[model samples]
Target chain A: MIQLDHITWNVSGRTILEGVTVAIPANTYAVLMGSTGCGKTTLLEILCGLRQPTSGRVSLDGVDVTDLEPRERGIGYVPQDLALFPGLRVREQIGFAPKLRGMAPEELNQRVNRLSEQFGIAHLLDRLPDMLSGGEKQRVALARALAARPKLLLLDEPLSALDESMRAEAVSLLQRVQQEHSLTVLHVTHSSSEAAALGTLHLRMVAGRLEVESKG
Target chain B: MRLNRSNLCWLVLALITVSYLVFWALLLVATATYSTPDSWLQVLRSPEIRHATFLSLVTCSLAAGFALLLAVPVGYLMTRLEFRGKSWLDAALDIPIILPPLVVGLCLLIFFQTKVGKVIELAIPFTYQVSGVVLAQFVVAAAFAIRTMRGTFQHLSARPEDVALTLGCTRFQALWHVALPAARRGMVAAFCIAWARSLGEFGPILVFAGATRMKTEVLPTTVWLELSVGNLEAAVAVSLFMVLLAVLVLVAVRATGEKV
Candidate 1:
């Protein structure tokens, strides 16, 4: 559960998010729809602890998480770039978080294989990031981010980097995976259709103010 | 039309570097292992030569190890922190790099002769000894390693480490398991280049370590000592040793970084 109240963040003194408040219930999907430069990604980053809000209170599961570090927020964030480590193999990449958390090798391998199989990425385990197709890369990135089973998952743009064919396929895959994990999601993107496809709650930010859209 | 000509001219100028590279290669080959069978055997068999080479390796390894220890933390702090006097600290690291080798050596000599010398000597065995060579090498190698590594870390995104942290890894764990592993190629490259440079370091070693025959005579210092004493053959022999060490480092460096 993420409860963001009166959040304000400024980059280089230019306000990105101004007094925005939102609550995301655990296991519920939240999608944020906005135009370019709408601070959608910034809000996602702030919630994950990647960027600090200039002024605000962020509570996670009723605990104050405002000053917490991004890693400490129990978030699995997939940035716009998909940000896969180029040097790491698909299996190595997916297993990185658990390795960092010092999970036993056998345990990590089991969890990684289970996630890989679920995402249909088991065959591409030894492949490099470049070798994977667009849809495949997206799945690998998601699997890597979700490896640790974080409470919240932040996706900057689910299909932004994919071609039209891959994008359609990946969107459905993302929906399945999110539901399977029972994750609280903050999906940020420019497409209303993409948001409507996964969102239980919708948010729109224009001119630095966050507005809750009317329920469909 | 003019841009095409300029591009051709730039390629020509870049190709011109091959001439000097070939010349250096020829120079190294002519002296390496020597033409005569006895002299080659002498280099391997002579206890003085063997001991000096051993001492050089030991000292250079120690210096390179120390440089790595100091460079990683210093590089990380400089790259991550925004503290007062940060720029000054960067400039300080570059002091040995920009300063002429002879000037750095001279400064070290003066330092050892003064009150600071006594303090350093008391702390670690140094001044006109093998330890002195290690200290001199550390100053030069650490500067180069830190500069290279800091740039490497800056080019890398902090996102992967952040991702690791979110999965319950601590800050230090994220750095060790994720960030540092990602930087494996660069770190290895830095270490090899620094080791190569230290192995071939001459001026600072001469001034601070005093080329004390078997005690302080590293390969480069041995070459200088032999040449200054008018033994050209011995000088060429030691020169050959230094060149081999350099080529090994070059090959090691090329092997590590995969251009990902």
Candidate 2:
């Protein structure tokens, strides 16, 4: 499980996330829905070790990884921008994490091939990021993050960049990948429809606290 | 009536721009004969000229390379982190760039003249030595390199490194594979400009290193020495070579620009 306990995060001496406690159980997808400036991305950053909270703890799989580096937590996060390396070809971008973890070349190649096929991105493996369409780039980013088989996957506004038709395709791709990897996902988005479609648990960020919202 | 006004504005702008451009072009290029066959042969055959050119190439390349290597981390620190003295550090990195080259040279000379320079020399000396030229060049060129690299790091999204860290890459590895790859073109532009700055460094080499012939002379210093000794042809020859090198760098600059 991925858990946050009484987490308090302040930026520039102002509280952003305070006394937030939550758990994302294994193999379950949770959606965090809120209005803009609600600190959803900041929460994801804290979980992925991109940002450090002012106080409190983040735990993954029963171990406190609050102070650990992002790489040590076995958690994966895709940011709003997708953060694709612009100079690299799609295949290299997707294989980047595996390469860093020092996986064997044969294993990496096999993993890249398998994920590429799974995401319907086998044809885009050789193209650089600037050449790829928005949807293609999003798939590459997701594929790159998933190639490591992270214990917890964090998706931030993953469908915001896609057109209507592409979003339909991507929602299916996302569900399939989450199920196939057996990942516990905490997807943060502003869209209620997206939340309803993919998430079984709904939480809202209000006044820097996580609360179960009534959908009346 | 509207077309007449627009056409008149366009004609005046074109005329003024073309006139200035043609004048500047002729000043630099009309001297094609200034780069004579005999001077080329003379420069090639003269051991002093050859030695100066080689020394310039070696010292400038080394200084530029070292500056770039060091600037990557320092620039990262100044740009990406928030320390107690971050604003001060940012301002400090920029002081050298804005200081007149001659002033920077004098400051460095004083630095070497003091106890701090003495202690540093005990570690890695730069007092009237061959290494002094490199030291001088690095001081000036690194200022430019740091500025360039700071921008290179700024052009980066910063999210890639964040993602790489999440994906199990160490900070250094993330810098190498993710941010650096995305920053490839900027780094190349920085390298070219820094090297060019090193080659053109005259004030620091002259003041701190004393422009010793065959030992401390780079292209700019060689040009000065030639002019002092009344060898205008050789001075022009050296200047011509410097111009050619600058052209090569600008071509690289333009190519890199188009790539990004």
Candidate 3:
């Protein structure tokens, strides 16, 4: 479970997120919709510890994690840019976090292989991110985020850059991944189609205020 | 090969680039013609030339190594961190690059005259010593390396590091595994530029380290010394050596997949 208690964030005296409070249960795919600059990404950053709220407390599983670093917060984050490392191959990028956490070689390799197969990027294991297409990079980025097996996943506009054909495929792929992994996911997007497809808990943001639209 | 306007533009640019290459080729040819095998052997066998060559290699390498060590942290700080006076600090980093090398050497000379300098000199005196040559070279070369490295970091997106942090690695681990590896080509370019600059540094070393024979002399100072004593052939020989060294460094940088 994740709780954002009165999370208010301001930068340079301008409010980006104003007293936003929300609670998300485990295994719920929460979809957040907001127009450009409506604090969707800001909220994700705050949740993942990339940025801090001016005044708020974040509790995860009944424990306050407001003061913890991103690495210690036990969350997986994928930004809008995908940020796939250019130097690392697809396999290395997928296994990066787990390798950093000292997972054994055979286990890490097996995990990478399994994720690659699930993501349909097993053939691109030796290729760099720059060589991967938009959809391929998206899959690799998702695999990388899941490599560490975090309890929560934060994605910011993951499929927005893909073509229509790729977007439909990705929507199904993401839905399957979320259900199969039982991952608590907070996905931010401006597209209603994406929100409707994957959102178990639908929320909307208007001028820094969050409103609950529907719950499944 | 047509006489069209676009072809004319291409021809002009090609000629300009070729002209530059020809100028360098002509200089190498002139130096080779002037320096006979016997004269080359004589210059190579001379104790003073040999000592200067060895000292130049040692000091320039140390300076470049030290510059790299300083550049990595400074570049990362300048790129990743924002604090009060960050813009001011960024502008201040260019002072050494823009200031005259002789002025930089003069500033160092003046610095060592102060009370703080006296204390530092007690431990490691740098005025008119071989270490002074390294210091002089490092002061200027580090500025260039820092500039190059900062540009490198600026071109790279910070999102990868952010992702790494969200994963399981600490900040330092993120930098080591992701950032540094991404910056490898830039690092090679910076080091090569700094090394070449250090090798050719003259004004600062001449002002601070002094162009003494068999002492603090590097290749550039060796040329000046040889020329001053009416050894034009020897000076040309040293000049050719410097040119060859520069070309070697450039080739190495290119081999590492970075354009000069």
Candidate 4:
């Protein structure tokens, strides 16, 4: 579960998110819909610990993670740009977190192989991010994020850069993966169609406040 | 009868490009032609020239290494951090790059006479020494390295590092694993720029380290010393040798396959 209690983020004496509060249940696919420049990304960033809320609490899996670093929060993030490490190959990128955590070499290899196979990027393990297509890069980014096995996954406009066909494919992939892993996801997008397609719990943002639209 | 504006623009650009290329070519050709092959060999093989050559190589390498050591962290900080007086700090860092080389050397010379500098000198000598050559070179070279590295870091997106941070890595680990590797080509370019700048540095070394043959004399100081005594042949020979070394350094860097 992910919870934001009375979250308010002010920048330069202007509020980006004001008195915002919401709860996303575990294993729920929560789509946060808002117009451009409506603080959707900022809200996601706050939840991921990339940005701090001015006055509020962020809880993940019933633990208060407001003061915790991103790594300590046990959250996976895919930024809008799909910021894959330019220097690392797909395999290395996927295995990066586990390697940092001192996972045994055999276990790391097994995990990487499993994720690659599951994400259908096994053939691209040796390729760099630049060599991959947009959809392939998306898959690699998703696989890389999930390799760490975080309690919550936060994606900021992950499908915004893809074409219609690629978006459909990515939406199906995300849905299947979330179901298979029972992953709690908070996906920020401005597209209502995307919200309708993938969200188990729908939430909307208006003028920095969150309103729960529907619950599954 | 009349050229179009686009054609005129192309003509002017091409003329300037060719003129610059020809100027550099003529300078190399004149230097190479001024000295006889035998004199070139003799100048290169001479004991004093050999010592100066070795010292130049050693000092320039040290200067470049030191420059990189200072540049990486400074560049990263300048690019990644936002603080009060950041603009002022940025301008301050450019002082070494913009200051006249002779003035920089003079400052170094005067600084050693100060109390803090005297205390530092007691532990490690820099005035009128080979170390002083490196110090002079580094002061100038590090600025260029820092500028290059700052530009390098600026061109890189912060998102990768942010992603790394969320992936069970601390800030330092993210820097080590993600930022450094991404900046590898930039770092190499910075090192080469610093190394080449150090090799060609003359005014600072001349003013600070002094032109002592077979001791503190670097390639630039060697050129100055040879020219001072009316040894034009030896001076030109050393100049051409410096050119050759610069080309070889560039070639070696390219061979290392650090292309982005």
Candidate 5:
């Protein structure tokens, strides 16, 4: 479960996110929809601990994580750009988090191999991100995010970069993976169709204020 | 008519570029041709020239290494963090680059006369010492390195490091694993820039280190000392050698796959 209590973020005396509050239940596919420059990404960033709100409390799984660092929050985040480490190969990229956490080499290898196989990127494990197609890079990013096994997955405009064909394929892959892992996801997007396809709950942002649009 | 105008514009631009290229080519060719091969051999065979060459290489390497060590952190801070007076601080970092080399050397000379510098000098001699050569070189070299590194970090996005943070890595880990590797080419470019700058540094070394024979005689100082003694052949030979070293540094920078 994720709970944000009256979050407000201001930059240079300009409010980017107003007093916004919402809750996402565990295993819920919550899609946040907002127009461009509506602070959708800022809200996601606050939840992921990338940016601290001017005033708010962020709780994850009933634990107060407001003061915790991103690493300590136990959340997986995929930024809009994917932000894959360019220097690391696909296998190394996926294994990055676990490797940083001092996971045993054998266990880390097993986990990386499993994720690569699951993502259907086993063959591209040795290749760098630059060599991968847009869809392949997306898969690698998703696999890298999930490698640490965070309870909450926060994806910011994950499908916006892909072409029409790739978007459909990515949507199906995302749905299947979310169900298989039983993961709680907060997916930020502008596409209503994407929300209908993936979200168990829908939320919208209007000038930084969040409103619950629908619930299933 | 539009096509003719475009062609004329391109022709003018090309001529201007070629003129600058020709000027540099002429300077290098003239310097290379100034002295005979026999004079170059004699200069290279001289014990004093050999000592100066060895000192120049050693001091510049040490200075560049120190510059890099200082640059990485200072550059990262300048790029990644925002604090009060950041603009002022950024400008202050450029002081060494902007200051006259003679003034910098004079400042160093005066600074050593102070109580703090006197205390430091008691522990490690720098005034008119071999270490002074490195200190003078580093003061200017580090400024160039820092500028190069700052440009490097500016070009690199912070998103990868942010992702690393979410992936259970601490800030240091993220920097070590992601930022450093991404900045590898930039770091190489910075080192080469610092090395070349240090190679050409003359004024500060002459003032602070005093161009002592076989002790503080770097290549630039060697040229000055040779010219002071009316050894024009030796000076030109040393100058040509320094140019060669500069060319080699440029080649190394290019080999790193970074823009020269």
Candidate 6:
């Protein structure tokens, strides 16, 4: 379980998030929705250890990870831009985690191949991020994130950049991937339709608080 | 094409570009024509020429290498950081580039006269010494390297580094694996520019490291030395030599398959 206790973030004397508390059980998909300035991204950053909460604790799987670095916290994050490394090919990008951790070559190859085939990005292994289209890049980003196999996946408006046709496909792909891996996800988006379609647990950020709504 | 505003603008820009290239081509032709084979052979075989050429290579290479060492961290900090006095810090990084090269040399000369500089010079003196040549070249070259590196880091998105961090790589790993590889082209360009800048550096070297005959004489100072003795052909030959070296560097860099 991921537990956020009394998370309050104040920036330059302005309260972006105040006393925000929430709990997400393992393998649950929580869709966090709010307006542009409602601090949804800030909350995601706090969860991912990119930003520390002013007064709160972040617990991951019963361990207090509030003080842990982003790497140590075991959280996978995909920002709105997808932030793919242009220099690395899709295969290298997907296998970055195992490569960094010094996994054996055969095993690393196996892991990358498995994720690539699973995500249907095997054909794009040799392609760079710029060569891929919007939907392809989305799938590659997801594959790269899932290659590490974190306990929690944090996505900030992952589908916002997609065209109308691609957005629906991306949503389905995300749903299928999350379900197949039994991954716990916290996806922040401004689209109610997206929240309704993918959220197992619906939550909204109003002013500076998190309110749990009915499950979609 | 007709002389529409857009076509006219294109024509003007093309003419300006051609005019700049023409100036350099004209100078190269004149230097090559003026420098005869006998004079070139004499200058090439001369002990002073050999010494100056060797010293120029050694010092400029050292300067460019050291400039890169300082540029990477300073460039990264300037781009990827937010701190108090950041604006001032940004401006400070540009001081070397903005100051006249002569002023830079004068400053170094003055600095070595101070207590701090005197203490430093006591260990290994810089002014009017062999080390001063490399130091002078580095002071000017490093600024260009830092500027190029900053642009390199900025051209690359920070998201990849952030993603690398999330993927269990530490900050340093992110820089090494993701950021560095992405900025390789830029780094190469920066090094070449710094190398070229150091090769042609004159004012600072003249002021700080005096043009000692067999000690601190580099290519630029070689030109000055030959001219000072009224050896016009020798000076032209040295100038041609520098031009050839720069061309070789540029060609080698371009052959690396990365645009400068």
Candidate 1 lDDT over residue span B68-104, tens digit each: 7777777777886677898998898898889999888
Give all candidates' CA lDDT scores: 0.81, 0.85, 0.91, 0.91, 0.93, 0.90
Q: In order, what is each prediction's RMSD in angstroms?
A: 3.5, 2.8, 2.8, 2.2, 1.4, 3.1
DockQ of 4: 0.86
Q: Which candidate, 5 or 6, has the higher DockQ?
A: 5
In terms of lDDT, the poorest run of 10 residues in model 3 chain B is B251-260
| Pick by TM-score: 3 or 6, better one | 3
Which tens-of-lDDT digit does each residue in A84-159 have in candidate 4? 9988999999999999999999999999999999999999999999999988998999999999998789999999
Docking class for candidate 4: high
Reproduced native contacts, each prediction: 0.68, 0.89, 0.89, 0.82, 0.86, 0.82
Q: Residues A53-118, candidate 3, lDDT per residue (tens digit)?
A: 899999988889999999999899989999998799999999998888889999999999999999
- Looking at model 1, the pairs that clash are A71-B165, A71-B166
Angstrom error of the Cα, residue A65, model 4: value is 1.7
Clashes of each: 2, 0, 0, 0, 0, 0
Candidate 1, residue A72: CA error in Å?
Answer: 3.0
Q: TM-score winner among the candidates?
A: 5
Per-residue C-alpha lDDT of model 3 across residues B1-260, encoded as one tens digit per residue: 56999999999999999999999889778879986878877887789889999999999889998999899889998999989999999989989988988999999999999999989999998999999999999999999889878988998899999999999778899889999999998898889989999999999999999998888989999999889989898998788888889999999878767655
**List of clashing residue pairs for candidate 4:** none
**Cα-based lDDT at residue A167, candidate 1:** 75
**TM-score, every prediction:** 0.87, 0.91, 0.90, 0.95, 0.97, 0.88
DockQ of every predicted complex: 0.56, 0.82, 0.81, 0.86, 0.88, 0.76
Better of 2 and 3 by DockQ: 2
Q: Per-residue lDDT of A52-156 in model 1, one digit per residue for the tens?
A: 789999999999988888767788988887878757899998998788778899999999999999999899999998798878888988999899788888998
Candidates 2 and 4, the one with greater DockQ: 4
For the predicted complex of model 2, DockQ is: 0.82
Better of 3 and 5 by lDDT: 5
> Which candidate should be chosen as best, given DockQ against the real structure?
5
